[model samples]
Target: METREHSATAGPDVAPPVLTRIPARMDRLPWSRFHWLVVVALGITWIFDGLEVTLKGAISGVLQEPGTLHFTSAEIGSITSFYLAGAVSGSLIFGYLTDRLGRSLFFFVTLAVYLCGAFLTAFSWNLWSFILFRFITGMGIGGEYAAINSAIDELVPARLRGRIDLIVNGSYWIGAAIGAASTVILLDPAIFPVDVGWRVGFGVGAVLSLFILFLRRHVPESPRWLVIHGRSDEAERIVSGIEGQIEKETGATLEEPEETLAIHPRKSFGFGVIIRGMFTLYPKRSLLGLSLMVSQAFLYNAIFFTYALILTRFYHVPAGKTGLYLLPFALGNFCGPLVLGRFFDTIGRRQMIAGTYTVSALLLALTGYLFTVDLLTPFSQTALWTVIFFFASAAASSAYLTVSEIFPMETRALAIAFFYSLGTGAGGVVAPWLFGTLIGTGSRMAVFYGYLAAVVLMLAAAVIEIRIGVKAERISLEKVAEPLSAKK
Candidate 1:
């Protein structure tokens, strides 16, 4: 039997810690192993995601090559938009499929399809074909967010979920770092033609996909998913097998854990069931989606679209050096979640959300000021960018985890994809256009970013008002999902 720890911090009148019974053991080494797989998978996914981030518009020089396929700047921008469309569709379609068809299958298929798209995109004969293939690849990237996050929610123990989720999300920045590094390593202009740089970058994603697919073979389907689908027999077997490992490790005498399972557990799924369940089970998640979509679309696109200008005009940074120039910035982003995530469960979700947002906003504003004042040295510029990037990355990490945990299992995948799409599609897609248009006059870019920072701070303010906020309980999918839909 597992022993419980009492919280002396709780008032004498407060209730004791209540444990949510799960199908398998949460204490064994396997739990950590399970999370490792997710972390690795996320890292791999981000590598490809990172490649997209790097290769998207970087091909301007390559496209200028006489023998290479030609693309107008407008056509190139359309391709990026096309990629975002794929992401939006992937989030909704693959998200629903993950829940209905089972996580393992969707995971495999999505990875495969994404890989093929990347391969096709790399070898495209024309800009149109490249756009088509890029869209296909992006769908996989979009699907990955929902599929990976849902799997994490269902499989990880609640208490560790927040921290783990933060870690997983952080991998995307690691992808960015890798992307930047790869520019220097794989695409050195002296040794390799610029034409080969984009192709090499695309190839990296395809290779990474293969490795991730191979690693996923040993990963198990969520026990919670099985029980929900009414696969008691299979769920029991998985649970028992996990417990058997726990017995060998902890040597704690086991008692039958109390658990209630769904009846007529769904065996098969269809588009209709996924679509209906999405809204029915996740009414409130749309709010989160709106927030995330707005936040991501705004910040990411703004930074990406304007990076060259920011580095050159703001920091006196050279254009060619951009490849390795973002290291500090990426590092800050990479570290934010691991450092901040530890406190999310205990610190109160709203406070963390607000705090991180305020910090990020302030940092961005600081970067803008340095830019406007013409006071930027390369060293000082990089330092300021690093700190700001960290805050932004951490805040965004928390959002993804919160969204994943705050919906019912019935619509978990859809909720993840839906809101993510909104954030990335709406906020991300328009951010560049808005930033470019608004970034007129002196310090316009700074002021524009300042406005975005303010909006995030506003979101932080409103988070506390919502009753369904992040809680300290071991963040089980159950607590996050809410009983609103299941009660029906």
Candidate 2:
């Protein structure tokens, strides 16, 4: 029987809708090869992002040395800031396209865009060209965060969503770990010229994107998206194909989907509608998402972007040796989500998110105080960061998970983009510069002040989350938040 109806907004060009069990069909499936395909194809986006941003920091000192880019600490900070600005712009722009144009299109486009940016970065002749390339690369990654996060959340099984999302997001540090290890060799003056090693580092990310692009081809668009856009027939067909593939792979009888949602097919959403839905219809979710985004963005950008500078400026670590410190830090961040992700599913989102955020804050406060008093060596400092981010990374990753799952199906991509851009723009774009200035001042006390600010913001966010967080675990997307086009 036909399950969908036309909204007044769906135009004559829209096809007649049919009933689809796509959402239920998707959410009820067991883990299969198909899920692995999606994870590898879409999730590597974080790896590229981890690689890109980590390379920026990992090579900061290399760029400052003679016969390289000859950049100053401030210039490196500015370059990183430009990348964040590009990311902000990209998220807003591509985010809208993902919602309007469908997830399948933007996944390919964004990956290609990133490849172009990362490849060109290797050819940069000076700081200006380097910044321009970095900005372009950032735009690609920013777009990926919106489109890919929306797709992943929409498509993954409800029971597995929290852990999978956290793991995928945390996988950024896997890239960071790879970047750190590679830079240790790439930045070695004995093996390659100082100038050539850094350029090769940028090329590695572009090369990695080629593999992901191939894997993404077999992945399908969100059936949830197709049905709401008056394409329920297509949605049903895709889900059927998915079920067939999963059954063949697992050789187990698939359970029938019990839930079905009816949506009034929408042609498109206007800017005014999107804005209203985000701010008016879902006000608390909006605020919670913003707080999470901003706090994590502030702490991550302020510290990670300038970490090498801290090592070189304060502890006298060599430019090449900086990666050795970063490798352990990246592992700590990576392991956090892998270890703690399941708890977000089992223990509940509110308790886990709030607890992680609060604990990370306390750890940071202790770490900052120790640093201010000159009680930390380079080794101890990295150790503290490893422990601190063991919690902070999961909290930061949950920030992404929260924003993606809390809104209506129609607004998922744009909402992700909006929060990411706002939070990242407000916090991320300014953090590197702020920390750069503090590092420039050569004062441990000055940098500690920045740490204090991050702690306060994190605590405030934890309070907000505890009070108003969405307990979205093991719930279908439509149940968590109804489709905007649902019949009342």
Q: Estimate each model's TM-score.
A: 0.86, 0.94
| Candidate achieving the largest TM-score | 2
| The best candidate in terms of lDDT | 2
For candidate 2, the clash count comes to 1
Q: Which portions of model 2 miss their true places by more than 4 Å?
A: 1-19
Query: Candidate 2, residues 1-488: lDDT per residue as tens digits?
Result: 24645455545644444456778888999988888989999999999888887777778877898898799978986897889888988899999989988999999999998999999999998999999998999899999999999999988999999999999999999988887788768888899898999899888788888988988999999989988887777877888888899888888878887766766676677777677777889999999999999999898888887888888898999866777888889999999999999999999999999999999999999999998999989999999999999999999999999999999888899999998898787677678778888889999999999999999999999999999999899999888888876644
Measured with C-alpha atoms, the lDDT of residue 161 in candidate 2 is 98
**Deviation of model 1 at 143, angstroms:** 1.2
In the order shown, what is each candidate's alpha-carbon RMSD?
7.2, 2.2
Per-residue lDDT of model 1, residues 255-306, tens digit only = 6645532222345545565556556555555555466446745675677666
Model 1, stretches more than 4 Å misplaced? 1-30, 249-256, 259-264, 268-285, 314-316, 440-468, 482-488
